[model samples]
Target: MSMEHHPHDVFFRSFFSHPDTMQALLQLLRYKQMVWQKDDGPLTPILPILFYHGPDGRISERFSQLFHPETPEHLRPQQVEFQAILYNLSSVHKDRLTAEKNLEFQAALLSLKYARDNMDLMIDELYRLARTGGTVFLSSKRFALVKLYLLHASSLTYDEIEQKIHTRITDPVIREDIMPSTAQMLKQEGRQEGRQEGRLETVHETVVRMLAEDIALDVIARVTGMTIEQIEAIRQQNDQTDQNQS
Candidate 1:
């Protein structure tokens, strides 16, 4: 398979691998490259972004490769061992960790939001953990709360998102950092509104062209996600506008 397909294959593997035995070391390679660039200290407990179908979850051999490593495969085995240390702490008490360590795990958990759809369990755990007043890396950043919504929002597609990694922000902390800029938020909102307006214009223009050609109103409605009544109304408006232009 192509390199593009490799990461997805690894995702599938993660879905099937043992929850505890799956190589945590491999994940660190990816985390270090992407999320954990700042810290290189001892291992800590972190909730990884687990991906799968439905709530029942699953186990597979593919789990070892879920993380894409920065270094060559030769160095990854050692990194994986380091990562295993974090996974082993999955059972540790969240309250027992230092403020910094708590934030590290929470940020990791937030990152996992992109890997799965429903994050009810993860969110609940975050709230539960935050009650201890532990620090999360994201907490230091602006718009961290908004980042949680984007991360945990069930409406977006993880598969489509993973593919758009180069163009989009996949790291929760990074997104949070950028999203807080008033200029950035306004620009994004404006772009979204523009897209919606463009779509509506396309629908209206298509209906007008079809009406001129004497196509059925129902056909225009079906193609444009509009109602038949709306199409007829547009047709009337078009006729008047055409008359004025003449």
Candidate 2:
């Protein structure tokens, strides 16, 4: 599948979709544009931040570094000069992420850093967060997003994931809220194993669930083993169903 359709791409894009993640860039451009258009007030300075979480380290921080290396030093001063605050999750220590006071932010960074290669560590941090952060962590929307990320990003089976969640979170209500039903898991496994036929309805339901979660079409296609065309059709049908019911 294309990188654009990849599960990790979807997961990260969804995880970072919150405004706070891109607030700096938004504010910077908005204020700068306002200052230019209105010419009534000084431009508010804003820091630019780039959050990166790839297997390799970031190559450069300064915008000017992207220029040709042979560019003369004398002319360098004319080039745009600015450094973004880089939060390279790959380089950040797990301890530092765990130390983050904001439980939601900590979970996001940890998931980004370790979800692929370090599932054990990721689960451990999540367990820790759930245990320590208590009702607040369990109730937040981030918890659901994190759970969804793990479902797609990790190689662990659905039962294994549920077991881990069960082991970590002792509250029955929270566990019930977090875990998918056995029927759902079986349907997911059958879909993954390419069992169609009578399962079309099941598959459509799964697609609808993922779509409701704001998962990308390509990502849903990958997960459900459906074509983008099919998923789009289901989405349209779903929209019509909602419209007619309303």
lDDT of each model, Cα atoms only?
0.39, 0.60
Candidate 2 backbone collisions, by pair? none
The best candidate in terms of lDDT:
2
lDDT of 2 by residue, 2-110 (tens): 0122222111122122223333233233323433453345433434455665457334556566668899989988876555566667787878888888998788778
Worst 10 residues of 2 by lDDT: 1-10
Q: Which sections of candidate 1 miss by over 4 Å?
A: 1-100, 113-115, 134-139, 142-149, 152-191, 195-246
lDDT tens digits, residue span 1-246, model 1: 001122122211121122533432343234334323333564333333332222233333233445454667786775433222222223334443333354544534343332255344444444444444434433543223233333323454433433343234444644344335423432333323345654566556656754553333333454455786787588567656755786
Residue-level error in angstroms, candidate 2, position 25: 9.4
Tell me, by TM-score, which candidate is best: 2
RMSD of candidates 1 onward, in order: 21.0, 10.5
